[model samples]
Target: MSLREAVAALVSDGDLVAIEGFGHLVPVAAAHEIIRQGRSDLTLARMSCDVTVDQLIAAGCVSTLISSFVGNSSAGSLHELRRRVEHDDPAPLRLEEYSHGGMVARYTAGASRLPFAAINSYRGSDLPTLNPEIRTVTDPYGSGDIYVVPALRPDVSIIHAQRADEHGNVQAWGILGIQTEAAFAADRVIVTVEEIVDDDVIRSDPNRTIIPAHAVTAVVECPWGAFPHAVQGYYDRDDAFARRWSELARNPHEMHVWLDANIRGTSDFDAHLELVGHPRDGRLNVTEAFPSPVNYGGRR
Candidate 1:
């Protein structure tokens, strides 16, 4: 299905949406589509709330954020996030703050269908004070208390990958940040990929199939979808756009003007890319490299 259809069918207003990828492969295109569709009051989640989340907040689509860090990944602050937090400029943004470890444990617990996860991460931290959800209990069999974060089961989780087969079997590599856990924990999953390959291609590299088709609810083939964030084999991060966005995001009106002109002004991501000077031939491509192929013997 198209990204439009997927988001429309799977995502709803006020949904707890998780768009996961560490430093790269963030589903910024899907984010744009959600914004284009005018989704609001979302509780957005990611380990690092970077440009993607910043844009959502800037557009007044997000009402809350769940993550450890909130800043631009490459440089500078997420002024929009700061604006909402400090002044409530566009909207009141609630936050569920946790350490990176705490968030992973929460997602892992949710994926495993557990109630909560206990960890030693918040032992000496002050995050628990600000966010009261981080609680503690005495270990039944052991000595002392431990901090626990509740499970984070997102209503829908979106991820961008290098490729997936028509069956929605997703395969990704390099800096996969809890994407598997996030997808498993989600009630529905939407994957936007750079390309869609044959099942034979996905079967050729079974180890790379991090999220199987059974867990996926929608598959969207969107080349350059993870643009501005490096997709493993397709393109490099668009630092130029990020820098410009950061500067514009400093002023709320300018930020919305930019968003209106660049994102809302276009029909789809491709048009937005064209408007932003994308389709840079050969410039963003990575130098070709391949690893040794391992054989999965058949016909025993």
Candidate 2:
């Protein structure tokens, strides 16, 4: 089956989904399509950095979110998310925050199918303030400040890569992280790729292969897969939109309007492309209308 179909199949109401990517690379397009289909009561778990989270929130597809941070660049200040969670309304959103390392560790534990993972990172810290479930326990073996991290297996894991074969062998260009762990831990795995290369390409560089075919349930070819975001040699980050999102996030109503115009209103990537012109040469020109921090290292 196609990656899109696989992703769509795995998604059900109230399923916890995990996505792999950092900032603007290796996001699962197929999974986003599934989200676009409007499955209700979905929870998303993310490790550290991703722009897609904002897209999901803007879509109103996410009911609960567990992540280390949420912002334009790197956890770009989750202003809107905070508002939804903190609001004293009929139903407030649920949010669970974790440290970057803590998220990694949880996924790692889940992937390993272990009862729990031990870590000293949160010792003597207020991490429990964000998540009361985390408990500190004394280790009989004297392992030094071991905290039990519950396993985090998700209903599905969606990941993106530079290349993949028909059989689902994936080749990531750089920066392999908890992706493999998440894939292993999830009940289903869906992958999106820039190209469907021949098996020989993967066979030639066996060592470079990160996700083998058997672990992948679906693969789709999505060129410029990480549009408006970084895609290694193909393109840089989408600074203009990132800045606009950061600003809009500050205002809930403004964010809704922006989402309605640029994201939800659009059907496909082409529509998004029409709204935001292609990058000139290798860079995107930032206009005064979308003001960004001077140090913002987005598209530039």
Candidate 3:
């Protein structure tokens, strides 16, 4: 089956999809394709929201969101979500704020198949105020410190990596970042990679291979998959686009127009490439001029 199909298999109506990546690096490309194909009543979990969140929200694929924050720092700002929340829209966006360590602990508990994991990171913090479900239970073993957090098991997990084998072995390159836990906790896994290397390359450095083939259901080779988002040394992020999106998002009409022009109405990345101009041989011209922003009936 194709990588998209493999990823799509894990998604269903009303599934809670947990995506592994921060800002832009290592986004679940195949999962996005699946979402574009149309699924409803979806709840998304991520460290922070960015282009991926914007695209899913614009597509109307996401019914709820669970993240610490949303919007691109480089983008002018994130107002759409804030406005929606402030207005208390019927389908008000669900914002679950958690500390960095708390988020990691939740994912780890999910991966371990444990009912809850003990942590003392948020003992005196406001994190519990936002999420009252995170109970402060005493240590069963009589340990003086540490509290337990309920396990978080998403229906499916989609992640991106630098390389993978056809069998689905993934090399996260030291920035594992919740992927290992996500893989352990999710019912299914779908992975996308820059390239599919030989099994020998993966076997040679077993420690580097974060996700084993057994855990991954699909492996797709997607070059430049993390466009507009950075992948460490691989490519510079499109901070300009992010900034513009943030600025336009303040006005709903303008946001829709911008989405239509850039993301929506476009079939795939190739079309997006045409709209934004493709990088020359995997190298972008930082000095090259960018297109002027389209007017969307909002403050410019």
Candidate 3 local lDDT, residue 278: 74
TM-score for each of the candidates: 0.97, 0.84, 0.86
Comparing 1 with 3 on lDDT, the higher-scoring candidate is 1
Stretches of candidate 1 exceeding 4 Å from the true structure: none
- lDDT value, candidate 1, whole model: 0.89
Q: Tell me the spans in candidate 2 whose CA falls farther than 4 Å from its real position.
A: 1-4, 74-76, 88-91, 138-145, 279-300
Best model per lDDT: 1
In TM-score terms, candidate 2 sits at 0.84
Cα lDDT tens digits for candidate 2, 194-230: 7899888787667667788888877778776677676
lDDT of 1 by residue, 159-255 (tens): 9999999989999998789999999999999999989999999988899999999999999999999888898777888787778878888888888
Strongest candidate by TM-score: 1
The TM-score between candidate 3 and the true structure equals 0.86
- Candidate 3 deviant stretches above 4 angstroms: 1-3, 143-146, 280-300
- Please give the lDDT score at residue 47 for candidate 1: 88
